[model samples]
Target: MSSKVPLPAGTTLGKSFEYGIDVNLGTYDVPSWQPVRRISGFQPSPTPQTQDAQTYDDLGAPNSDVTGWSINHAFNAQVNRSITTGLYLPEIEAVLARTDPDAKGEYAVLDARWYHKPESGAANPKDAGRGFFTVATTRQNSGPNGEIEVLSITLTGKGPYDKITNPFAGWTVTAPSISSVSASSPGTNPAGTGKQVTITGLNLTGATAVTFKAIAASSFAVVSSTTIVAVLPSDVAGTVAVVVTTPAGVSAAVNYTRAA
Candidate 1:
């Protein structure tokens, strides 16, 4: 959905919507949109009915129509969003206030939490990391008249953020900090095309040269410290590694399979 705020000219968005969660206030919010899945079309306007509780027929009836209902009434458009908050949340209190204003005691509250552990069929954390940080908490009434509703919350740290996103707490990267690496050629195996590859593993910057061990003698070339790009030597095939060295330390050969 759009407001009177017109977007800047020529701004296009990709597929997928994003959401988020906030621990500060123990609330869930929609933070942003990330294209994780492919999409063809969208329903930009779905009648524009509100999600808040009302006195009328169940889900509040349309407040008239969005100017011209006959022209376009549905919100069906591909939105590339990073975060959007204030989503619909059917508050149990709202229902109690409207339906049972005076009723007190012995009532249940419908607060929700971000369930990462099993039994809470939530999306995996790694997959979610690429997406937004959001969740919904709908305080549905404990009684019969309380129907299902939703309120989406997006997490936005109020304070300053680090220049570089540090790894999540209690997590570590396991990729080896190796010494050196090399790539072989698809000498015989037709499966692998002659793919040019860059070997990685050690402090390889300012390297004098990178070469194919058994493939070609002249297949060596100077490269940067962290990585070195090289072509597939003609003689070699299958997996092999390239050696790398610097003033600090020498790296072990990192294996790379050859492509035909």
Candidate 2:
């Protein structure tokens, strides 16, 4: 089924695969894996293939082995993740401290999800890429430049990864939150074109970017965890989604408008 939706004229489709989206992990009730720095290694197992041999028969027709045929087989799945230290995540800690742990065993079950919102258009704003997984190993690394020690967790799954519809049932995604955003000019400029804007939110520190409708701000300053100043990019007249991407993950998007 398909439906038509209205959009402002001259509104161009923005780029896809913009990085810095937040990734969360955990179970249905006591969801715990969160505040993750970044994640990767979400891929499917390679398909195993085999072919049958063919030969010419007395009737000059091709004949193939009756038992020889290609078939699909199940394989183990794997995922890699990197997260900050010091928070001491209880979920992962308990799994690591288990008396008996195995990558393929059911001792370390985990669930993961990543949120991506389109900068423009009537995007659902909650497209979550999710999967069921298990932790295989956890490694820690550090550098000499006073960098904080980061822990990397390797995950493996029994079969294929699947999506989760209701992830935030009990616990929330542990990351920065955006409360409000406004233009710094004297009057209300909905378009926000070429105007300095201030965004009020939580966990604005270590913010890597501030975007208007997914268009990155050329210049921005993080005054504090609750405030960020940025110059809005010129864009088509329409409602836009604004968000801040940090090392921890991307913040929930806030709505902004651009006047014609």
Candidate 3:
């Protein structure tokens, strides 16, 4: 006898939109990754070049040998143009640059990485692929009345795609940095006992903890990805360290002075 089991309740499946492609805006040596936005119907097509491997002595069926393979990434996107500013999105601008007569070097070739972003938490390295690609863009000129214009963009691989770490690994929570901390009320000595201070730096979103002189802040609020407002706790005087912690990791300590 055999039996079958059904999937458990509340099981979540991956969505097509979870996958993303990021183009390198900077040089390959020092890459600045930015996601290609406003895209729909993304598809990756991999084709293999085959050779005849069948021999006359073969039994039932003929055999084929795979010599090489290549992949073409394609997607459709609505023309992202701002009506007020009359500016196209950065990713769209990059794609348009490729059509220029004088386009060369990096503008001609796009260094890109595509990966699946986890439903929640950090991105896994194994879910990413990186390579250089040539861009092909076709703009739709005519469609049904009142229909929005669309662009068909294809990224033809220059070489093989390589499995690599997710360039946008810490999409959820990147470790925060403290550039400078200033008390709300100036000339305040010993920044503790309900004293509010503004902490500024990069990646301050979703902060889990803020500590002053190794003592946890009484309370904290993440204003943005680059700012945090925290109430200091009681601590002994003389320059102390301030640090922020997030899901990804803890930030390097920045010195804060607390007068004795």
Candidate 4:
């Protein structure tokens, strides 16, 4: 049988390769043992469990269990493995070329994932330094008590990204100008819905985001280049600092009184 047959010196059983049994039950996780195959004429419906959107742990995060790193390293270490043998899909040369010209991103590695499952089996799976895989569960072969899925993975990350964007450029980040700021509608009788009121002041153009400094207030919502439309915090009923900032620097606190 194929099970007893010996694979060539450098044989890699792809995730799609059939081994005639539930790989979960089999020693090497053969697709045959999976629900996609065992069950006759079965197809899983797409749902939250199998979201098309994939979520991943941060790279080098505390403990990205993501197993098979060693195998990945070994496969990547080959550096000179033959491509025709299906050893490497994302070649090192192409990897280096597509990288950002920032750090030493010239070198990158690639891995595979399941189409609808990721919660099962090992990710970045490798075999004898010749084959690699990322398994997902599927209903096609899973039994009455089984689960199925496929995982979608991509080659991402070279380093930690700086999540900060500069908002201040040629604009001078001077201390905020005060022109009678307060938290009150036009007037109960004929007042503006304060819900959409505007605050006019100097140095409001470069303020990308704004925050209020009322000890009891929640954070504020920045609405425009210079103005802010914040929900009144339950306890933000008094004067507080209206601080504005830009990528270049922060401005002095401008006091805005909350109407009683």
Q: Which candidate tops TM-score?
A: 3
Error of 3 at 4 (Å): 5.4
**Candidate 4 local lDDT, residue 191:** 16
Cα lDDT of model 4 by residue, 33-124, tens digit = 11112212122111111213233543443432232222111111113334576432223223333343542422222221112221223223
Q: Residue by residue across 142-184, what tens digits does model 1's lDDT show?
A: 4677543322222222222212121122212122234433333
Between candidates 2 and 4, the lDDT winner: 2
Off by over 4 Å in 2: 1-174
- Quantify all predictions' global Cα lDDT against the true fold: 0.32, 0.53, 0.75, 0.32
**Candidate rank order under lDDT:** 3, 2, 4, 1
When summed lDDT is taken over every stretch of 10 residues in candidate 4, the lowest stretch is: 18-27
Give per-residue CA lDDT, model 2, range 38-141, as digits (tens). Answer: 33333333223334555554366554445422211122222233355353433344334332434444544555554443444443344444554555444444
Q: How much is the lDDT of residue 185 in candidate 4? A: 61
lDDT of 2 at 31: 34
TM-score of model 1 relative to the true fold?
A: 0.24
Report the number of the highest-lDDT candidate: 3
- Candidate 3 ranges beyond 4 A from true positions: 1-4, 7-11, 57-60, 82-85, 104-107, 121-124, 168-171, 174-201, 204-260
Order candidates by TM-score, high to low: 3, 2, 4, 1
Looking at candidate 3, what is the lDDT of residue 3?
Answer: 83
How would you encode candidate 3's per-residue C-alpha lDDT over 79-137 as one tens digit per residue? 87878879786568777787688877766887887877766655666877888888889
